[model samples]
Target: MTAPVAKLLLKVFTYRQLAVGGGFLAGFGYVYCGIGFALSALPGYIILEDHFQDQFPKALSASSLFNFIGIAVLPPLLQYLKTLFGSREAFILFGAVTWHMIPAGFGLRDAVPRGGCIDRPSVSKRHAKTKRDLKFVNKYLSFCSCLFYHKNYAILVVTEFLSSLIYISWALFLVSLGTSAGLREESAVILSTAAGVGSFLGTALAIGLFHFQKMNAYTSCAVPLLVNGIGLVGLTFARDFNSLLSLTLLTGFCLGVNISGMIGIIPSLVCRYHFQQAVVINYFIDGIAYQFGGLISGAIRDLYGSTLYVYGFAALLSFVALPWILIWACNKDPNRECEPDLS
Candidate 1:
């Protein structure tokens, strides 16, 4: 919906109306992001759960590795494009290339079986009309109700929110923090690149640990949180580029592990049919948390005039959350039968 509309606006508008076009693009971008999150994560996890059930963690790690590569490349690639062409032309070119996704979307197939995670069948016209009438009232209410139905899922949602808050805050401030620590802008950017490399390495390491070492889901999740907390503390004392880069790498590695564990463990925590809903809810909260986290971190940086304080605050929060995760893992129901390979 938003994608096509954004594409159309980009195609029709000229550089003179760039501001108007950008406004339309920003307005629709959030919707597109939300939709993309659901589509990419839910279906991919469902398909992996259905087929590669035993190797879900490895699969998730591999997927995250690829995603990290893209994230690491996109910024520099866009900058290069902006340099080669002016900002207006670069944006136009980007929009034109991205429009290819519409055609590419046609290749997607429903990997889930009929009556699986999501079931939608053709209904009678009358029934469809009736649903439309009630949708306005029921839609948000039902979504809100889902948040409280499952205790484990609710815990995961909280964990995701906090984790996203910390992770995004750190990511958004990493370069600034590096510069504050006496590095040049180019060096700070290089540190960010090092973080990306660390993320790739972390995912690869998680894959190995999950596959060969037989690390359980709980340990996989909790260890990364602990590692990240420690890394954040380390960052508070990092005074030079080398030290900052090392701390950034450590944080990035733990971030990769945490992300993979979160996605990989979902199938183990809930039944197949509920997996998609759980992920959708978790990511929705995560998105909100990320936005607020950035804002809050910015505020903290402004108030304190120090990224160290922000890092310390995030570390403190991480440590505070650690015990709950440990307790949850300790109390996990042994008889639960969502996924046999969770161990």
Candidate 2:
């Protein structure tokens, strides 16, 4: 929703104003998108939890295929459009097409499970005394703080923060790394495309494993993180186009597995009522981490005049996330059942 508005505004604002306005709009869009995703994912997760609980991981992996496809295609598509139509006009055209999501959103059906327990006792009634005792801001702060008190949620927050930090840093510097290695711009783009293809293949493989081999969430998550770390380390040493491209593909594949596994395992982590909040918080943190990652990586790149150190630092961060995830996974009950809810 905010995407189209941002695009339209981009045409009106001067370059300076556009930067400020674009930043605000991008932040707002990230928050809104996080909320929207949580709302949308909740119902689908509920249905999956209720009916297809055993195959939920596979289903999620299958769903991620489209995301990989978009990643693989959208950059070249957008560049072509920009070349053909000019920047502002291209954005306007893309915005016009993006507006179709409004109608598409309306077409979605309710997916609440028939029988489920949700602790939605009236907030007004339940919090009346507390409201009298505390200010609205205080109440809000308290609620947010409680989310992090949960052991699993805490671990998730830490792991996700680290993962996003490293991943975004790598992504922002990838093309620069390629150029530094003497690869042509076209070849760098091809390398990114190959990574996307690898992502698609990784998601497909995860789905196959989930369905046929009954792969566990821990394996799905841990293996990818390890692979991603290794790939990042490999990138620091890669000097040629083929070596860089191969490492990027490996990194992308690991990323795909990590994303699918993280999302797929959410149902196993929290009750349905808390799931939306958890996911929204995770997305919020992820957005912040992405911003910071780019800034930090850019700063380091400028300071050092080399990408090798940046890659090495990101790899170190990736490795740092391993223990948190492993501890959480070790404590998690594999056969634990979630409380189903429609809320």
Candidate 3:
């Protein structure tokens, strides 16, 4: 991390992430649930870059607003229907009946496809059409690269890259870290579940932390980085499952805190118009970073036993982001009132 990045973390990164997280969970639901069915699910979430907010507030706000509305309305709406109908049985029965009837009604109204003469053109003409469509989309998407040059954009870009690199290794290694210490698969699952429980707890803690000081995004990230590092480093010497699980919870808590703060922070820093672009870019960075990590972890693990070096390397990469955040904070004026919506 460079000095400005470090400084920025303390002053700006926290609120930025908080802003982004609000929309990220809701807008990103498709990624979470859809991908779960398609791929082996990971117990995790996504973090957008902090700088994207600087350029895309309107888009971000719209996304976040809908999410806020959904969270507020969904539970109550379901409960209201249940109560109004006087029982869960009636509520569900009606819903099931509607599901079948609505589709059946549509089916009843459907006009079946009527055969027509082939509209297929020659191979050369078809190839031309495909080429034109690809060129059009690629040209439009290239406009998104404007975000790449801004310093704020770069900071987010790097953090995501580093976070992904670190997370990929940490997640898989966590299993072995427990099992090697005599944890059975069930125990490991329970321990992972414990960490999941701690995730919500960590979010609660972030609320209090925010109340104590403004933003504090970088410091919030730093705290978790240090805690997770210490825990994993300790694991190199730990001989039992309970200790491993305890450390796992500690790390999970830190992760939970990190994600919550990050979501809250990103939108605060960017303009609403750029929100969609920023989100897309953030994911691109994360994807590239994780691709590198997968190869690195396998190579290291294959070359050596479960050792301190691999974990240490991951910790060290996280540390790389700290200085940039700190340096970012140092250059900013100390006494300005914060912009709204960042908290």
Candidate 1's residue-wise lDDT over 69-117, tens digit each?
7656655565568889988898777667656556545654556453422
Ranking of all candidate structures by their TM-score, best first: 2, 1, 3
Give the alpha carbon lDDT tens digit for every residue of 234-332 in model 2: 999999888888898899888877776666766566655556566667667887898789889878888999988899989899788889888887776
Per-candidate Cα lDDT values, in order, are 0.70, 0.71, 0.53
Superposed by TM-score, candidate 2 places the C-alpha of residue 6 at a distance from the truth, in angstroms, of 22
Please tell me which model should have the higher TM-score, number 2 or number 3. Answer: 2
What is the alpha-carbon lDDT of model 3 when measured against the actual structure? Answer: 0.53
Candidate 1 backbone collisions, by pair: none
Query: Model 3: residues >4 Å from true position, as ranges?
Result: 1-150, 207-213, 331-343
Give lDDT tens digits, candidate 3, residues 1-343.
3556656565756766855764576558545534442222111111212323222222232233333333334334444566677666755754454354345334433233334432455534644554454464435554453243234544655665776787677655665666666777545555555555555566666655544544454645666766766765766677777777677677667765665555445554444434445555655666666667877986787788764456667777767767765654453422211111111
| Candidate number with the higher TM-score (1 or 2) | 2
Candidate 1 residues lying further than 4 Å off, grouped into runs, are 1-41, 86-104, 112-150, 335-343
